[model samples]
Target: MAFLIRKDFPLRGFATCGDCGSNLRSSWSKGKTKYYPYYLCQSKGCDSYGKSIPRDKIEGAFADVVKTLEPSPNTWCGLKPCSDVHGMRDWLKPKILRV
Candidate 1:
């Protein structure tokens, strides 16, 4: 018997360049004995010249960051959502109307 498998991709279209504010894309090299995937910036007139960052290096760095993440009561309190409404005054609201 055979089984079919599926995967979910949450990072399909969100990563971007910090310099040009452009979307980053991924590609795989062809005609190779082994697979190699990389990410590149995809923007016109941008200084980022589609440089490739190795998948292994990126994953290792991300693993380090994840390992450093720790949760505590103080950390949770520091992340509380803001509840201020000072900017909702009549004068501060947008002056446009639509039908």
Candidate 2:
């Protein structure tokens, strides 16, 4: 299949090439009947240079990994029930964050 290209890339700066350590560039590739989003390594000599990873695959994995992260316990000052905007304000107003 041949691809038609566009320049915008949501993961442009944050994602990198796994084989060459160059950044992964992204674009919308036109498929036989549709447009597909792909992330690819564009470094000149890399073994994985032209291979394309579907955008949903990479971004979905990224989101999954992000879901596993948590703020450090020491950095959490407090949590109060968010019943309303005023309640939220009340919760935040008195606490001096721990870290």
Candidate 3:
């Protein structure tokens, strides 16, 4: 009752409530014979306040939302240079222009 078996909060800062706009809080809860993870809104007076949503439900929805998100070509271009091998190549290549 005072401690949790699972204490990780993967969505704490990223997931917010639709009604309250407050960041969702996660916690481990006692359920019959097992401890279950949950996401909830702790903002007072909000419609979702104190309502415990299962971790799987929220994370599944989060995964689905991001499933269709593809980085643009520009993103790859920008990140390519940030990668170690590419960065070294760019840095080591000749910068002088031949006349």
Candidate 4:
């Protein structure tokens, strides 16, 4: 099958292969009746180098990880104001003064 670059793959550069520690690349395959999305490791010497993982499975696993990361409200509140350098400097000023 001819391979084409797809921009819709959300995890293209973000996901990594468990076995090879290489970034996972995604592509679409034309089946008999439909197109299927898959993520694969392209590393030359890795055990799972050419193995394809179904898109749903990879995305679902990412979703599961995101679900488990429930940051507390206090942490969010603390970080919300430090979104920029000036804000971070201001936030750190008080702590530095105390130290």
TM per candidate comes to 0.51, 0.63, 0.68, 0.68
lDDT, model 3, position 18: 74
lDDT of the candidates, in the order given: 0.48, 0.64, 0.66, 0.68
Error of 2 at 36 (Å): 0.3
Cα error, candidate 3, residue 3 (Å):
20
Q: Which residue runs does candidate 3 get wrong by more than 4 Å? A: 1-7, 80-99
Count clashing residue pairs in model 1.
Answer: 0
User: Which clashing pairs does model 1 show?
Assistant: none
**What is the per-residue lDDT of model 3 for residues 1-99, given as tens digits with 9 covering 90 to 100?**
122223376555556787887767788999899999988899999998999888888878777766766879886676544457444434423331110
> Scored by Cα lDDT, where does model 1 land?
0.48
Report the Cα lDDT for candidate 2.
0.64
Taking the tens digit of each residue's C-alpha lDDT, what string does model 2 give over 4-78?
223454445556666776667787899899999888888888898889988887777667766776768864566
Position 68, candidate 1: lDDT: 76
Candidate 3 weakest ten by summed lDDT: 90-99
lDDT-based ranking: 4, 3, 2, 1
Runs with alpha carbons beyond 4 Å of true place in candidate 1: 1-14, 73-99
Q: What is the C-alpha lDDT profile of model 1 across 33-94, one tens digit per residue? A: 87676656777777775776565554455456557767787866765343432322222123
lDDT of candidate 3 vs native? 0.66
lDDT of 2 at 92: 36
